[model samples]
Target: MSTETPTPFAARPGFVADEATGVAAHYGNPLSEQRDLAAGRALVEAGHRAVITVTGPDRLSWLDSLTSQSLKGLAPGQSSETLLLDPSGRVEHAAAVLDDGVTTWLIVEATEAEAFAQWLDRMRFLLRVEVAERPDVAVVGAFAGLQGVEALAPNGLPLVWEDGWGEVAEGGVAYADEPSHPARDWTYRETLVSRDALAELASSPVPAAGLLALEALRIAAWRPRLALEVDERSIPHELDWLRSAVHLDKGCYRGQETVAKVHNLGHPPRRLVMLHLDGSDNVLPAHGDTVSIAGTVAEAGDEGAGAPAREVGQVTSAAVHYELGPIALAVVKRSTPVDAGLVVDAQDTAVAAAQETIVPPSAGAAAGVPRMPRLGAVRR
Candidate 1:
């Protein structure tokens, strides 16, 4: 694995580089730009994400058959997300989906584009769907306010998938809203720009930002990214991703059975939480660092011999938001008390963390409303 990241924007002057999951961290001033972008006043390069195209008549239905979202009737220009899971319901891949009438676009981390395309190709099995990876189209990150970013109504608006996760979308339910949701103002979205057009866009006077700025806002909103936030044991419930990535009443798919079984009966083994890290040391914990409760193991489970607070979780995404300093997202054991004070082992020093529940311990048994069975299932 290459420890270095690719810098697509390095051609621009003042474009310093750092690694972020095999991609550039930022050009400069990630914190300041984060605030600007959060308020929808600026744009940032999302060179880390890649696009894959699925065409042919069977595109929508074929994709619906393989993933965890309702895509069969996806209208042209509609935005949604889907989870590709193993039969056991462990999250395998996540894509920000959008249909342009002629093709279905799968926006995923650059690292997974090729492999995920190969996986989809292997599953094509005589289906009319044609899977093709399109590195030609790049993702540019920004919010709603930035002018000239909207899609043209004539070309069906360039397949811009307005992020629906921050707000409740149709055929979904919310599990996080306590103490006020951080996504209340998260209008984050990504737009596809031609590789040739990037130089001009990057040179535009809008003022560029970096991944660090984006991460801060994303972590604050508790948004989970497939590259950094997931592991082999991850499931949708644990990250509270079902809000927009799932349709509880969708037709059968690969892991539908397990998806239903868990939400209805079994509780997720782990839960997602946002941590307010201690900034006293001016140190931040990186992803994969240990996150343990302050109390002893016996205090966590009353039976075992005394041990330093058991490792409850690992930091998945961490950042210093301009507004919320030193924040991170971690997946802790479901049994880890929400009110429990935790600490992050940042290499050598320990940093205190205040837990803000994203997925509560009682996060099972989904509450969905009566569905009057898809009347004619509107054709898109």
Candidate 2:
């Protein structure tokens, strides 16, 4: 890791390198200019989804019964990741859930709201849970290095703060109208505040980073996000999602059968691994690039890389960090050689690469691979 510290921004958490500052200095025109705080924010809002809140007394028990993570024990101000699954154990939706004691808030991909809400509604038979979509809420994120900000949540998930960040608690749990920022999977609402105040609170003048930067940071930390790191055909074990989202000891849910069986007795069909792309040029392999190892290909498309352009795995997310160079998050078959040199066919050229395990083998990954754990798992 680079020992240099980043530059300081008033509201931003971490330091921005001089080079990074120069690259992001231009914000007015996105197309013709490099992205700055304003531009990055605009792009992030446009490209990514917002936060969705679910209110009512039955929220916790309701969501707990439907998702993989154990939410029954969630305190008033705690949060955690939850994975909704298909009957066969495939991932349907994943969200950062927040429990504000009375209500539960879910921060998820925008496109997933309708489907997830419908599913929740359909499942709400005699349960006390009331499922409604709260688009009125805004979602914001700050990098890990903010100084002097205290986090609101008890668990203090990484998504809540950067390395040096601290947070201030604005309101107590009982004050529904109090302004609150729940860390990681926790959610809170403030009806007393106007939209303007909410907007200002959510919109800081910090250097806004794109999904690309976020993706790079996420992949580096081994954190998996939906759509990019997960697929419908994939099981929770394959992505090591169980570590944070699935509670193995937790009671039953839709996919619990497969989750238990596969975990206790069988190996997952595939494994999530990180690839360090080699070669000089900055060309990043697209999401579906093929990976090759020892001239044999195992999986194809974005699911896995396949043959005669023989592939060992497929790139799910790839990025060139200002510091980490070119890196990727990929899912490869367990059969692929860990020590074997790998290559990615980015467009027409073959880029050399190395593979590391971010999620350990016991978490459904293959043995002897270097795995990076999800972000927040790191103890401060």
Candidate 3:
């Protein structure tokens, strides 16, 4: 689903480019490599990520006004994320942000880098901020990359933006309150490197992983990547993204009205769920598969007396976890019951799934009352 072509990996052997990112999809055995990486034995190629830099005193304050997160006080080396929403609050872009004193670094999808930089350039107004895309800079990811990030740092800005989705950030809300969240060990970090640096790593003694390995860990942790989870109708709440990428109390931003209205008064139209797939057929549902209850929808003038299967969700991403077997992350209607039995349509086959709720249906109704019209006064 990503438009990013993989960065050049000329020094790596046995890796093959089979995805849109053009990076290796696997180095022969993806499952074994998944285990190695999960056990902290490997690093994955993040050729799909792109880096952008915003320099000037106005960088932090200017970016704070344009995105969802509050970044006025973001200190150097602090990692965060921000979402650009359309006027309707649908997520248009997501950026992994890091401040390095003199500059603000934006780590975004390679496919989105140019456009994102251009957009920021146009938004700079009379501000001193200077936005630039760094095509010379590529990315590499590892769970323990932070400890060695200094060694991997490039000359100008050795940006190392840690992934903070594992826990709730300050001033954010958590919709998923599971005591032992499956992704508790999801400690991932990305390092910016020169093209030559990535090539050197490709030749290093350390083992390299493909896209599949990264995806398995991410899906198992219930993480939502914009390239995979976002559709035209996507909003931050549906993916439980408010837990990290959003600042609920942040002052007026482009889509703040919609964000507040959805959080305070209305429930998100849909919610995120983890699906334990019944891999009896050893088949995985591809992205964009329709999800329905485990039965068939009744059609008009239908002869069947029982209700027909109705689509309640869509499989956003699917993978085979080293521990969880086959699993998927899905976006379902909020009203879909938490205990509902689900089936994912994999073209010709319908794979069964057990639902694990992420964002509950009653998620935003904290006031515990029916919403009334704003213009009219309360009835006496």
Candidate 4:
């Protein structure tokens, strides 16, 4: 009684469909597949992603005027991402972008395809650009070291997009200044492939991984996904999205003023963190689960019988990593103590969690403007 369209890759052995994502959750052995994927020994079918194309001499400049990333000077075969925010500076949409000279391909979440394409079409007034979804096109993901991925490109131009999350992008700033950032080793890449190519791979010797493997690796790297991490109140600063999807020096856009003001004079109200969950119970916290201060629970234990733990944040994404065990990314109040022990409410049990800061409490106010003395203030 499911309405999900069957993926072309479903014919392979041990295929189990993810009811939520409409893609393969795993091919029987997820942990082994995760190791193989990290080792460049497998490929993952990202069929849950949608492809859109914009073509014309004005495509680059048109996009540059609207998104958070500067796209006017995008060179051929360059990979970048951009954010579309509401007028009030809340994140609305995001896409992985690649230009192949003749066309600019946008790879986005399948759930975002219709609305995103409709918005672009409505915005195209007398512009030379044309917007259309490429249903015939599909996305395949792999680590950077995977061999022969370049040959899968159409029109002799490589359509692979290598995300720039490992280092701070040009005209971008980092709030996570940890010396050993996990994103330092992130080398994920997504390539555009035709349906015929997908079928060919399904019948060939290329080993396949699934969404489970990819999600585990992505969570381990602390990579944020638009569909998972973004919410109605999300701002680029909260998730450290400015480090990749935002260009601080870009020209006027809908949310530019708020972005600048928060970065230079104010701090974000919330910060993103990675939670190291205790795996003893083997319970993984689901998205939107309430996160509470463990100290509050302990203090309540010292009191009479029962007391409620103080809510601190909410878990955004979670996964059981191949080597790291249970891990998750959560967004907590900026004032939450960095050293505070936390717990996630999972299946009626309090699972202990340790915080690894991704965005610090001190994030924002980048201009460092000196404070001016108030009138009639006494000098010490």
TM-score leader: 4
Query: Which residue pairs overlap in candidate 1's backbone?
Result: none
Clashes of 1: 0
lDDT for each of the candidates? 0.82, 0.57, 0.83, 0.87
Q: 1-380 in candidate 3: lDDT tens per residue?
A: 13353444534766777567777778888898887777667777776788898999899988889899999889888899999998899998999998878888898987778888898899989999899998777777878632333333433556777888888989788788757676578888887766666656666677777889999989989989989899899989898899889999888888888888898888999999999999899999999999998756444577774686789989999998888999999999987889889998897787989998888898875556775678867766
Better of 1 and 3 by TM-score: 3
Residues 1-380 of candidate 1 have per-residue lDDT tens digits of 12353444566555666554433466567777787888788777776788899999999999999999999999988889999999988899999999888888899988888889999999999999899988667787888788655332325556576898777767666678734987877898888877667656655666667778888889999999998889999988889888889888888888888888889877889999999999999999988999998755344456665766679999999999897789999999999998999988897878889999998998876544355658778756
RMSD of each: 7.8, 13.3, 3.6, 1.9
Summarize candidate 4's per-residue lDDT along 74-146 as a digit string, tens digits: 9888989999999989999899999988899998988898899999999999999999998888788898778
Report the lDDT of model 1 for residue 254: 80
Candidate 3 RMSD to the real structure = 3.6
TM-score, candidate number 4: 0.96
lDDT of 3: 0.83
What is the Cα-based lDDT of residue 57 in candidate 4? 92
Candidate 2 overall Cα lDDT vs. reference?
0.57
By lDDT, rank the candidates, best first.
4, 3, 1, 2
Indicate the residue-level lDDT of 317 in model 1.
90
- Order of candidates by TM-score, top first? 4, 3, 1, 2
Model 3 alpha-carbon miss at residue 123, Å? 0.8
